[model samples]
Target chain A: MGEAIVITSGKGGVGKTTTTANLGTALALAGKRVCLVDTDIGLRNLDVVMGLENRIIYDLVDVVQGRCTVQKALVKDKRFDDKLYLLPAAQTSDKTAVTPEQMKKLIHELKQDYDYILIDCPAGIEQGYRNAVAGADGAIVVTTPEVSAVRDADRIIGLLEKEENVRSPRLIINRIRGHMVKNGDMLDIDEIVMHLSIDLLGIIADDENVIKASNNGEPIVLDPNSKASIAYRNIARRILGESVPLQSLEEEQKGVFAKIKKFFGMR
Target chain B: MNRQKQQYVTIKGTKDGLTLHLDDTCSYHDLVMELEEKLSVNQTNEPDGPLVAVHLKVGNRYLTPEQEEEIRTLIRTKKNLVVESIDSNVITKEEALGWKRKTEIVSVSKIVRSGQILHVKGDLLLIGDVNPGGTVIAGGNIFILGALRGIAHAGYYGNKEAVIAASVMKPMQLRISDIMSRSPDYKSEERNEMECAYIDDNNQIVVDRLQLLTHLRPHLTRLERRL
Candidate 1:
């Protein structure tokens, strides 16, 4: 049976959808049968990020409500060649449209066929988050280096640890600006992990291409040389029980003249 | 006369009023019957003078508040008698348990994460970090062996004498009883020593070094060594 892992951040605009899309694609790239379940309901965006917006006919609400078969609701990702599929969330319906019990049943049915089911959770810890976490065997708490995001992640982790089905949740620090961390401006990886006291799954550096690729309906993991893509692949390998070393981030420093200019307070 | 010699209810005169000693070995019904008979016999001596104050003493017998009230009502039924006090040598087991719960220290070893609150009846000895947005409340004192970056409310149940001590004493807010004091806004004070917060004589929450607790609350130490 497949394992269902929910990707959630208690605060909004923290790259939960991006992580879900890239991780699912990375797992698919590793030849694992991956199913991405979007549980955001009214504010679904996983389909758009995966470039499968036009393909979604029957959504998560339809499958759980018995309006359509699970096979009928699944949108296949042609890029992965039968390796990846997405169960989109219904844009018209709210979080109350689906119940946690129905979500659990639906995920249990999907687990029989897929190797991994990544549930893309909504922002708040309400019904949508509950439905996303209901069937999750494990969880991935995504957060940025910002204090607000970290605080919300801590709250979510506390909630996740109380779940009977979900195991110890792991952390993924996303959108880290390497230079700001080097300059001791932003919260670094070690500080956040120490504060949250959870096992660090992986960290993704902030790259311009991530936003650009998402804007074009393609996840960053499609580009092999993309830094964010490489990080996602490493995270996927770690999820597959591979001990790949975490990629250390080092910002591109300028020449001696730039350092002199920086000393003189030049931009 | 033999029954009078083995009386279960004894009354004695004092300068202020009279003291009624109820027999600890007798049943509740027998004690009530004898007391009623004795009071009725003395009814002729009453009503001519002012009300006689009566103090009921139950030796080695624990009486519930309701039972004590019943005895008071029995005495008050007479127009010349008024109950001044009800004294007992023993207490109910529930009261003993409640006292023990209020005085004993509860030890916990877990992270009090954000949005979570740990509450203990008496003193708390927490061995984990209180993350930001988390809270730890205790009826007695609070002693944290780890970082306290969140809120700590010692004496939450209105125990004005309670204190909160932490190893890394950097909390967003500290409350002792009704008084609250927020940590200084500056984050540059990085030298985190063992610190404690307690209510001062001026009715304010004061955060100071943990060492001050030795002089401030010397009675907190309950350890007695004979060896």
Candidate 2:
């Protein structure tokens, strides 16, 4: 069985789907068979970000309801042949369409065939979040450098701790701006780590390439040269039990190559 | 050890005092016999006679679900029983008898947060602050190393001899057994102090400085101290 990972943030719009898409692709790029499941249901977007939305004929609801086999509903990643698959969410259904037991069963089936399973959890701590995390071995809580986001992340950590299966949840601070943090305009990386008091997975700096990749319906990790892509890839490596040095968001912005990369991408 | 084992008695130590784990299956007479045997063993270990206190761990499985009140009553009369987790699942009679024997010492390792009501059976040793709106009800003593701003009921088994000790005692209310008391309007002069409360000779609960109040709350009175 493969390792099930849920990318969850208690508050809405914290880049959980983006992290899942990129991590899944990065893991596959590293030669591990990965399956990315979008458990957002009605608010599905992992398929769109991975450029596999149009190819989705069957969704997670279909597999859970016994309407289709698990393999038939899996959307293979076009960029990485036989390396990555996505269990796209159903657009027409709500979170209640799938039960935790069914979700566990689906992930159980994928565990033996895949090396990694990334579940893009829904915004709130609702049925979707529960279902997505039911069979997960670990979790990544994505949050922005904001008070409300950190607060909600704290709540999600508390809820996850109550579950007997969940281990210590890792933290990912997305959209971090070194300049803003330096000027005392935004919360710094250390502050978030201290407040959340959890293990830091990796941090994704504010980069326009993320938005660009999303707009282009592709995960940023495929670019390898993109800074956000590198960060997500590092996180993926860390998830696979590797100890990598966390690149300071400040140090990355000072380098000339970063400036040129940003200029070329118009970041 | 074998003689004591036959009596179905187990013993543990905590910051408050000793906690005795009793076999619920054992008859009341056998249970007391085991307690005496345990005390004798302790007497040989420490050269002190029954200096190690005893507390009972009742089997929640054998006790009816509705018998929580009865269990609580038993604890009060015995002035030592610590009611452990109420068994709500499929608990067999034999399993219930064995579970109580393997009870671990109670240790609360996190900050008792708001809206949390934790009823600890044994002595509760808090590693973090007991925040306001939180609660800790222990059948034995409760020792809070940090600020205690919540409701704490220690010696809940009518053990007026039990004590509530904290570094900072700013609790909204405090109770030991059936005796209940609250801070005077939250504006009283004795708001922040290392103090202990116990019942007086007149049977009224009184609070005094740890050094000055020779008699603790829920037990001895100021007059008794002089005596």
Candidate whose TM-score is highest: 1
Query: By summed lDDT, which 10 consecutive residues of candidate 2 chain A come out lowest?
Result: A247-256
Predicted candidate 1 versus true structure: per-residue lDDT over B185-211, tens digit per residue: 777557757988889888998888899
Deviating ranges (above 4 Å) for candidate 2: A251-267, B1-106, B111-124, B128-227
Off by over 4 Å in 1: A254-267, B2-5, B11-20, B39-56, B73-94, B223-227
Which 10 residues in a row give candidate 2 chain B its minimum summed lDDT?
B218-227
Candidate 1 collision pairs: none
TM-score of chain A in every predicted structure: 0.94, 0.93
Q: What is the C-alpha lDDT of each candidate?
A: 0.92, 0.76
In the range B1-227, model 2's lDDT, one tens digit per residue, is 23333547666777655555656776755655555545554433333333333344555325454555654454433433344433343476666544542222367777564456777765577876666567888876677877777788977767676667787778878888778888777455545567666666665556666665443342333322210
Write down the C-alpha DockQ for each prediction: 0.78, 0.06
Query: What lDDT tens digits, residue by residue, belong to model 1 across residues A140-247?
Result: 999999999999999999999999999999999999999999899999999999999999999999999999999999999999999999999999999999999988
Per-residue CA lDDT of model 2 for A46-149, tens digit only, reads 98988888899999998888899988999997688899999999999899998998888888889999988888999988898899889888888899999778
Residue A251 shift from truth in candidate 2, angstroms: 5.5
